[model samples]
Target: MTWVVLTGRQNHLDQAATPHKVITNRDYLAHPALFRGQRPKVINLSNSYAYQSRGYYASLLASSRGHRVIPTVETMIDLSERKLYEHALPELELALNKCRKDLGGSFPAKAHVFFGIGPSKAWDRFAKLLFDWFRAPALEVSILDSGEWASIRKIGFCPLGRMSEEDKKRFLDAMDVYTAREWRDSKARTPARYTFATLVDPHEELPPSEIASLRHWARIAEKMGVEVEPITKKDLARLANYDALFIRETTTISNHTYRFARRAQQEGMPVIDDPLSMIRCTNKVYLNELMTANKVPVPPTVMIAGPADFELAAETLGFPLVLKIPDSSFSRGVKKCSTFAELKTLASEWMEESDLLIAQKFIPTDYDWRIGVLGGQPLFAIHYLMAKKHWQIVHHKASGKPDQGGIKTFTLKETPPHVVETAVKAARCIGDGLYGVDLKETKDGIFVIEVNDNPNLDHGCEDTGEKDEVWVRLTQWFLDRLERQGR
Candidate 1:
């Protein structure tokens, strides 16, 4: 992916400050080369986005030419009228109220945001959410204090000339982070046809894939004429520069991973763990309903909304049942209750965070079968053993680190035919994307525990039996889609 920054005043931008190409707004609008060449991310920083203004037309023309532009024409129009942006007030106000204590007891009348970077760490989250909602190079926001809370009164574009020296420094620094200033020069390497963005979080305690495994995939992709670049949460604005997005972090609908997936989908870029899959697979309650409706084998489950429903759950599932939050992952939000008292206590604590909970009949197993399905077919199989003296495969400690049990990989032919067939059928309940179907093999039958959208594919664990072929097939799935899209 390439970047092109446009500005009304060329003097405001120093070309040497960053490696990305910076040109006058007129050049972007008048230059024939930009109109006919490869699509690049256009950063429109014109003085004003008024109707028929230079910035307005710049974004309009970029969209018409199939290039991604910031502060899109719709965004400009939304900011032009208060009624257009009223729907966003409640969300902004809620975020502000959540972080009011961190504001040092001072609520300013207004603030400036540069490339989603605010003045202090206290406003960092609010600024990021603001940028996620409205993508622009610079913004001037009016803060309204109503005694109880502060809300956004207005949102408008801030021109380059209106910025102070300090604002200019912050803007440039934020741009550096957005573009990945430390990224290696692609000019020195072989040019690829497709640019793949692998979204990851280095600090994640339990990442979906290890850093070494991600690097391995990158090496393989490079050989196949694809460029795989590692991106983080801060790189949401850079989604336009990629042909496809591969999420390598833990995905949750409430976090930046979902935002990244959604942004990629909006950009018409192929993405694994697509937004729909995330929405469906992240919620166990939804999965229970989906599997039951589709006739997929699953354990007896009950939805607990309050004490009234507890009796029904206790009667149907019996004692020693497992309780799960709607969006439990990695065995964190799941618990086992041996008696009714424990159930009540855990339910009371867990219900505070969620409106409903999932209670299932306990099906003890030495190991759970993980069937990796990609593009609607079986990709790999593994037996995820339970942690020592723990019922779950992962043992999360209070210190934030986690301990995991060993894994045993099996080839597709070696895995039981019933397990493979049942896993495939379960995965089909979700969209035809990358999925991991967890099943418990018992005397009665094979039952699907849950379908995971973003499954763990580490260096030596899940990739053991399939080895390099696993990566080859995964990369091919993305390439096939890109070719169909004619990109």
Candidate 2:
């Protein structure tokens, strides 16, 4: 049976008053009687005096059809016609009085009424109130049309009304697939294959060697029976169909990684190197605080809030210090200051770029151990030896070059035991599923340089000369986790 729904006011022809034709047109267009013997049901859902004729018509129709007439009691008075704020005070008071009079009888738990004539500036104000009042879960109020109804069912409410039917349908389809995948039992049938995309620099495309390495890793996943799809940021949205994500590039909390991670979290997808982990790893100040709280050994460091604090930091931490931006990666914003003048000059430049800076005692070490920690265990450890002249391995000039002295791999067996232990402890302290810990072996002891949320797994670097044992172990580790998750 068809239903004629009249929202807001009704158009009356008997009176000389300007009629609300939109409501009448909607009711006429949705008429059910024209199709067959079935008569259309008319419901007058309005909260204004202008709907008096429509309410009367509904009562007449109900009496003729022998149906019960549902009349809504008027508890709210619309004051949009009143020009001044002072003029609306009395109508508001009258509404309050009506509410008090019918408090326990037939009045709803809450009365939400829209008080505007047209979709103008005044209507916008009333619309704001309508949204605020109708937002209550207990009160059932909405201004959704057919198109809006479908759109709301898909992505969510879009009050501005810009979504097309195609967009709505696509979103709905994705949501259906997402729900089905989530509810479906993996053990009952063959596991459904899912896709995932990772964010990578468009300019810094993965080299052929790196792509070969990824292919090798994919083969390893195939052997372990786990599916993986490595993609860049441009294609990340297409990965909405994926069950989980593994971001391989350096993604900061404030970058595209955060957006992708948030979306994945909302869609119930498992996102490794998630936003929380990225936040913890990207900020050097955060890591330092966490490490200190956990009693993890780290280099003595002082935070320089601005250039003015540099002298104080120098006095406190002493000279020959390391200056670094809190959220920089790949040794992008790190500098060594040997003298007080150099510290002041470097601090000024660093402060202009970033508000938070870390000044620490230089380890005076030539190499640092990069230990890959997966699921709270040290999967592999490699020494990142400094270039012959540069303090850090990532040389900016050679960054454009095909091959640079970025990382020199070494086995965990060759790394100092203390470094390995420190890396493992640091990773455990972070408590994330996947992370990388950079630790320096100083004369005193092993100190954590930093922990990275997204660490590089360059091709042939994880090779420990144990007959591809590391790759096999990593593949097995990932698969085991996925299997345990029942995916």
Indicate which candidate wins on TM-score: 1
Model 2 per-residue lDDT tens digits across residues 1-487: 1233344334321122112122442353345243233223233343322334543454444435422222221211122222322443343333333333223322222222222111223223333333222221011222222321111111012210232454334333422321222122234322223333444444554321255565566555544444455656544333443546666666867766787777767655567677788788888998999999998999999988876787788888887889989988777788889899998887887788788889998877677778888777777777777766777766555456422354566666776677777888888877656778988886788899999887777567755423366567656554565457554
lDDT value, residue 92 of candidate 1: 73
Best-performing candidate as measured by lDDT = 1
- Any residue pairs clashing in model 2, and if so which? none
| Model 1 error, position 371 (Å) | 0.7
Across residues 278-381, which tens digit of lDDT does each residue of candidate 1 receive? 99999999999999999999999999999888888889999999999999799999999999889999999999999999999999999999999999899999
